[model samples]
Target: MGTITTFQTTRRIVMGAGAIAKLGEEVRRLGGKRVMVVTDPGLAGTGLVDKVEDLLKRERIAFARFSDVEADPSYETAVRASEKVKEFKANVILGLGGGSAQDVAKVSSILATNTGGVSTMFGIDLVPKPGLKLILIPTTAGTGSEVTPIAILSDHHEKLKKGIVSQYLFPSVALLDPELTLGLPPSITVATGMDALIHAVEAYTSVNATPMTDMLAMQAITLVHGSIRTAFANGGDIEARSKMMEGSMLAGMAFANAGVTAVHAFAYPIGAEYHIPHGVANSIMLVPVMEFNMLGNIPKFANLAGMLGENVAGLSAREAALKAVEALRQLSKDLQVPARLSAFGVKDADIPGLAQGVMKVTRLLANNPRLLRLEDAERIYRCVL
Candidate 1:
């Protein structure tokens, strides 16, 4: 018999153009009077934050804002954010902005009820207590951190990114307002949309993928392939933004359960050691990893090619599988995503150290359909150079 699998997501998802209007009502409905909004400096004084504040005030829900989160949030940032949560005596936690803010909120929520530093709960299923009621509002249509049972923090002491995976990390609600992403700049739209694509691709090709997750991943891939360009070209188009947001959510759900593979495994170290954005790192490694993993599951790759809109008619599975890779390259080129690690200041001499770092993320590597040896990891990094 096959091994049984489990999938999870937030209890409630409120999605649409005007979903932010329910922020306060959702908190109140969940019996939370004091809410803590965790976000990053990039969003601190933006009208978006002010708009949320206004909504909370209109509903008479008292709230506190902590805007100290940074990209690839550090353990210290999470610790300090949790202190704010405790100081406010907040019964609810709201994560606003991108993945970093959401990750901080998820970790701080755990620290609110669990008795320890965030570092103590680093591994899988280590969190022992239920956290405060949590609501996540994603300003960007990427990361899907709002819906996942995972939180990633940069461990400065260790000089690598670490993840906390636990059921307790799942939020009580996810409020996805496509309107919030209207003003997103083109570069972010490209990077984040590619992030969503990677999530779906990795999940679909994961060794742990199930029939359920495959369906979700395929739908996500199709949506992203069809809508990312439109969204990138015109961020204000609600239709395009809505499709990207929905696709990103589905991809998040798929990966959160099926797990991501080597692309993410290799990307983590680049982000941690070099301060590259997670999405950009993933984008840089995407093609190389896919090429390396192609032979491991040719049929699946062929299917992916079809889903990505590559014409596979009259072609062998192996030939068609290669098209998926070319399609990805074309998409990256169209979006002007940097294709070389050198663009990010990484050198050929850095390959060995990065390969070693990739080994440390065995949790993710073990799920790759193609087993990645140390030498192969080095080669992947070099190929992107």
Candidate 2:
């Protein structure tokens, strides 16, 4: 008998050119008299945070801003944010930046009600109750943390990335405003957009993929591949920005259900050790991991060429799969994202330990199309090095 599956995403998703205007209404609709705005200093500097605060002020909603969210936020960072939420007595959380901010928001929401340390909530379905009402708005077209019921926090003590998976982690609403992404610099555009694209690519190829997840992943792959270039060249192009943002949300939904494969598994170790940005680390591993995985499922990998806008007219499945790899290579070249660990000062001696780190990411590795061994992980890192 076929296995039964379940799909989950944010209950409400609001998307448009100027959707930030709806934030006050969304907060009020969630019965929030007090709100916490979670974000980072960089986005706060962008004045988007000011605009959100203004909206909340106009609504006469009491609010507190937590703008210290760091990249790869730790469990302590999450606790501090949650403490601020409790201090402010916030009833709703407004997550208004990229993955780090949104992740902290998700964790903070749960931490407020779930009476325990963050470490206890690390595994799947561990949280016993639902989090507070949460509204996440992405300022970058990446991560898709707004839609997914998964959050990753840096375990600084262990020097590894850790995740919390629970239905309670899903936000009450996901607000996508393409206008918010217009100010992203080209380099970040490449990195975040690539991250979104990789999520879909891995989702489509994951062993646990379902027809429902594949549909979302396919649209994500098509939209991100088609529009990332245009979005990179013209950040102010609302159309490109809209598609990229939507693609990211769809990819998040796909991976939330289907899970991402070895690309992300390979990324976590380098990300934790070298402090490479998540997207950049994933980009570095994409080609090599996909090359390794395509042998197990060439037909699925082959379809990626056409989905990514490459012509695969008369080629064999294996050849078409190779085209997909070449397409990623060319895309990385065009976007100028770093494709080597060597750029980040990672070297030969680091490979074995890093490979060991990759093995422990069994959550993601279990979804990899090809079986991965410790030796295989070492080889993948060295090739990229």
- Provide the clash count, candidate 2: 0
Cα error, candidate 2, residue 325 (Å): 0.9
The pairs that clash in candidate 1 are none
Task: List per-prediction Cα lDDT, in the order shown.
Answer: 0.91, 0.93
Q: Candidate 2: lDDT of 103?
A: 96
| Predicted candidate 2 versus true structure: per-residue lDDT over 1-385, tens digit per residue | 9799988899999999989899888888899999999999999998889988999999999998999999888889999999999999999998889999999999999999999789999989999899899999999998999999999999877889999999998999999999999999998999899999999999999999999999999999999999999999988898999999999999999999999999999999889888999999999999999899999899998998899888999999999999999999899988888978988999999999999999999999999999999999999999899
Model 2 misplacement above 4 A = none
Q: Which ten residues in a row have the lowest lDDT in candidate 2?
A: 333-342
Residue-wise C-alpha lDDT for candidate 1, range 184-214, written one tens digit per residue: 9999998899999999999999999999999
Q: Give the C-alpha miss distance for residue 246 in model 1, angstroms.
A: 0.1
Can you tell me which runs of candidate 1 are displaced by over 4 Å? none
TM-score to true structure, per model: 0.99, 0.99
